[model samples]
Target: MDEMTCPKCGSSMTSRTLGAVTVNRCPSCSGVFLDRADLADLVEAENDWHRHTGPLTEPLPRITADMTAPPPSRPKARSYIETLFD
Candidate 1:
């Protein structure tokens, strides 16, 4: 395993392999330490994994404008039967 130092805090970093890509993570700062090329490689590997896993599940449908439109407003109501009782 290669040794790497954290760029932010200068703390020693540990190497880890997530999925198929290798990354260096900082211990003290809890920050991921990866070079530009390593970051790109990690993203590419993740995308490749997703591609092989097939398409993701469809997202839930969102409320449309028609569904969200407010109902028609009406004037104050008066009951004829109530008026007769009164």
Candidate 2:
């Protein structure tokens, strides 16, 4: 294991290797440490997992017409016979 200083607090960080990548974490600040390669690998894995699982689904809310508005003041439309006479 390699040792590094925390950038935020300058505290000693502990290093550990998981698989092929190395990670460092600060005990005092509870911060995670990762190299550029480690972050890229993590992002790629996350994207792949999301692709296989498909997109997430969300429920839509139901809508109803309002009944409180006043009715139309104009008269209803005339039939074809009534219109021919007029």
Candidate 3:
């Protein structure tokens, strides 16, 4: 297969489709290349989505366990709770 060079990172670009448009995408740099019509279509679609979206919408925050939070202190002795409760 023919390979296309990524303009940003010099990596190989692969073809990816969004809706009806085919765009050249660079996996390494996460870049998308589109022609004039393709860009226009993307912008129009984005605007349409924003226009129809509710004003109260807020971007969700990424949820991750706090690594700095000390790991659960292992019980110094086997708890009787597990044996009795079981």
Candidate 4:
């Protein structure tokens, strides 16, 4: 299973809502990962304590087999829904 692990520290992160933004925040480091879609809101939010490490315009790309493992010997077929979703 995929875990929302913090990059700054190896702590397990929890979801938090700052105004209208939902992000993964590390309690140990007080660092948060913002959803790209929510960044505009983050900028306009009333709070002024937040700082971002880098651009948070989008969430991390989903890790597929191509990223984590060697390619298969042959191409695998995609499901109907997978095709539609992709």
Most accurate candidate by lDDT: 3
In candidate 2, which residue ranges exceed 4 Å CA deviation?
54-86
> Candidate 4 — which pairs collide?
36-57
lDDT (tens digit, per residue) of candidate 2 on 16-86: 66555566779899788788998786666656555665555889545557646557796532332222122
What is candidate 4's lDDT per residue for 8-70, written digit by digit as tens? 889998875645677677879978687788877665542342332234587777887678765
Candidate 1 residues lying further than 4 Å off, grouped into runs, are 18-20, 55-86
What's the residue-level lDDT of 42 in candidate 3? Answer: 67
Write out the backbone clash pairs for model 1: none
What's the TM-score of every candidate structure? Answer: 0.48, 0.49, 0.52, 0.42
- Residue 24 Cα positional deviation in candidate 4, in Å, after optimal superposition: 1.4
Candidate 1 overall lDDT versus native: 0.62
Quality of model 2 by C-alpha lDDT: 0.65
Worst 10 residues of 3 by lDDT: 77-86
Worst 10 residues of 4 by lDDT: 77-86
Q: Look at candidate 3 and give me any clashing residue pairs.
A: none
Q: Model 3, 1-86: lDDT tens per residue?
A: 48888888999988866576567778899787878997787667666666665557789666678635557985532332122112
Give the count of colliding residue pairs in each prediction: 0, 0, 0, 1
Among all candidates shown, the one with the greatest TM-score:
3
Q: How much lDDT does each candidate structure score?
A: 0.62, 0.65, 0.66, 0.60
